[model samples]
Target: MGRSGPAACGQTVAYGLAVGVALAATVQAAKADPLQDPYGTWTLQAENDAVSTLKGTSDQYYTSGLRFGWTSGTNNQPPAISNLNSFIWGPGTQRIAIGLQQLIFTPRQTQVSQPAPGDRPYAGVLLATVNLISDTDVTRSVAGIQAGVLGSYAGGYQVQNGFHSLISDTPNRGWSHQLPNQPILEIDAGRTWRLPLITRYGISADVLPEVSGEAGDFRTYAQIGGTVRIGQGLDSDFGTPRITPGLDGTDAYKATRPFVWYAFAGADGQAVAYDATLQGSTFRSGEPHVSKIWDVGEFEGGAAVLWHGFRLSYTQTWQTNEFQNSKALFNFGSVALSAKF
Candidate 1:
C-alpha cells in the first residue's frame, strides 16, 4: 500500500501536466484571433487566516477546556482551515473570460488547555500538537459567450477536485486524502447592465450538474451547486496590516507579498454579495464525514506602487456571517498577493 501511494501521486501529476500543456497550446493558437482574451495574469500568494483561540469572553483572557466542538449533528472536531489560492485571469476579446484557481493549506495546529487552580497546578497548562500533512484544492475552468446573442448571454464550464478534509476539529483523522475520480461541472449565464454612474452590474444565474465515475470498487460521486460573485475593483488600502511573521524578526523565509492590489481600483470596489453550494455534504467513507454549506460576504481594498515588473501591495479582506449547514456561523480574514503581466 505504501508503494502504491507514491505511484498513484505520480500518475496524477502526469495527468495534470498533460492537461496544462494542452490548454497552453490551445490559447496560443487562438491568440491570432481578436475573440481571444489579452488580459493575462499570474499571481503567487501567501495567506494566513488564524482563528482566535476559544476564549471565555470577547474582551477577556479567560480560556475553555471544551474548545472544539462538532457542527450540529456531526461528531468530529473542526479542522483548522487556511487557503493559498492562485489564479490566472484572461478576458477574451469576445466579452468572455477564463480562470484557473488552486487553493492549498497544510501544517495545521490543534491545541487545548486544562483549567487552572485545579487539583494539579500543571492542569492549566496548554497542550498542543501540529500536523505536518498537506492538503490541496484545485479547479480549472473554460467559459465563453454566445457569439450571436448581442453579447448579453454567456456561460462556461469548470472542473474541481481536491484532497482537503472538511473536518474542523479532528484535522488528523478527518478522511483519507484520496484522489476520488468524481469531478463537479458548473455553468452560468447572465446579462450585464452598464449604469450611467460608470459602473457595470451583471445579474447571472448558475447551475451545477452531478457527475459520477468509477474508481475500482469504491465509486466516486459529485453533485453541482451555483454561486454568484459581485466583484468591484478597489485602489486604496483601508487599515490593512503591514506586519507579518517574516518581517517581524522571525526565522520564517521571505514570501511573496501577502496581498493583491489594483491601481485602477477605487474605494468603492468591495464585493457586496457572494454565496455558494455543495459545501455541506458529509463524507460516508468510514470515519466521521461532515458537510456544511457556507454563505459568505466580504469587503476588500488595497494600494501599492509599481516598479519595473514588480509591485508592492497591501490588502485586507473581512468576511462575515459565514454559515455552515445552516447551523454554525464563523468568520475570518485573508491576505494575499497579486502579480500582473
Candidate 2:
C-alpha cells in the first residue's frame, strides 16, 4: 500500500489520540481550582475520512489539530471596534475568548490515484480566532472571526510521514500531492432558541441558526443552516459548550457544572462559489480533467460529555459526493478533547 491508504489514515488518528491523551493527563494533574470559572482552555481535535473497520479502503484524508484559548476576564481585552464589541457582547453578562490553532491535512492513496484532477494535497494551517459570547435570560448568541495561513512549509506532510514511518517500520521520506500557499479569513454569527417541549423532561433543547462566509486563497464559500440540540445546555457551533467568567445566579442556569452531557444533530448546505483547488485561479492552478460540483451538503450527529471542566466529544459526518464523477460518498469521524482551567 502507498503512503495514502486506509492503514496510513488509521495510524495517523491513533497517533493523534496518543498525543492528546498524554496532554490531557498532564493538564488534569495541575493545581487549578475546578469550581472557579475557567479562564482558559486547551483542545485537541482529529478528523479522518477513512477507518478500515468502518469502510474498507475508501476515501481517505487525515487531519489533526490543537488549540489554546484564553478568556477576557482572566486577561486583557483584545482590541476591537468599540461599536462592534457593544453589539455582540451585550451590557448584561458576556465572555470574550481568543484562540490559536494549528491543523494538518494529508491526501490518501485513493485520492491521489483517482482519475479526477485537482485533488487536495498535503497542507497545514495556522489560525487565530476571536469569539464574542452573550448568555442571558432573553438571549443567547455567539459571533466570531478567524484568520489563518496555509502552506506546504506548515509541516503537515512531515508530521504524517513521520507517524507513518514509525507505524510501518520504515524510514521517513517525502510524498506527493500538496497545495500552494494561501491566506484565509472568515466571520460568522449564530443564535440559539430554547425549545419549551424538551424542558419538561429535564432536557434543555434549542435550535440554532447561523450564517457564515469565508474568503481565502484556497476557497470562497457562504453557508446557512440550523441545528437542533436536545441536551443539558446550549452547544457551540464547533460542538462544545460556551464557558463564561461568571455563572447565572439561578440554580437552574448555572454557568459551570460538575458533570454535563448532551446529544446533538444538525445539517448544512454549502454554495461553493469559488474553489482554487477545483477551479484554476491566480493563487493556484487548477488540476487537469477534474470534475467540479459546486453544491455540497453535510449531515452530522454527535454526543459530548463534560466532567470537572474536562470535555470529550465524538461526531460522525456524512457528506454528499463533491465531484461529479466521484463514486465515493465522503464520510469522516471527528474527535475533540478539551479542558478548562
lDDT per residue as tens, model 2, 43-79? 5555555422256323343345545665543222444
* CA lDDT for candidate 1: 0.23
Best by lDDT: 2
Poorly placed runs, candidate 2 (over 4 Å): 1-38, 50-53, 56-68, 71-83, 87-92, 103-122, 137-142, 169-174, 187-196, 233-257, 280-291
Q: State the lDDT of candidate 1 residue by residue for 33-102, as single tens digits.
A: 2212122223333332432322212111111111110111111113321111111222221211222222
Clashes of each: 19, 1
Model 2 TM-score is: 0.68
User: Can you give the lDDT of residue 232 in candidate 1?
Assistant: 30
Q: How does each model score on lDDT?
A: 0.23, 0.52
What 10-residue stretch in candidate 2 is worst by lDDT?
Answer: 243-252
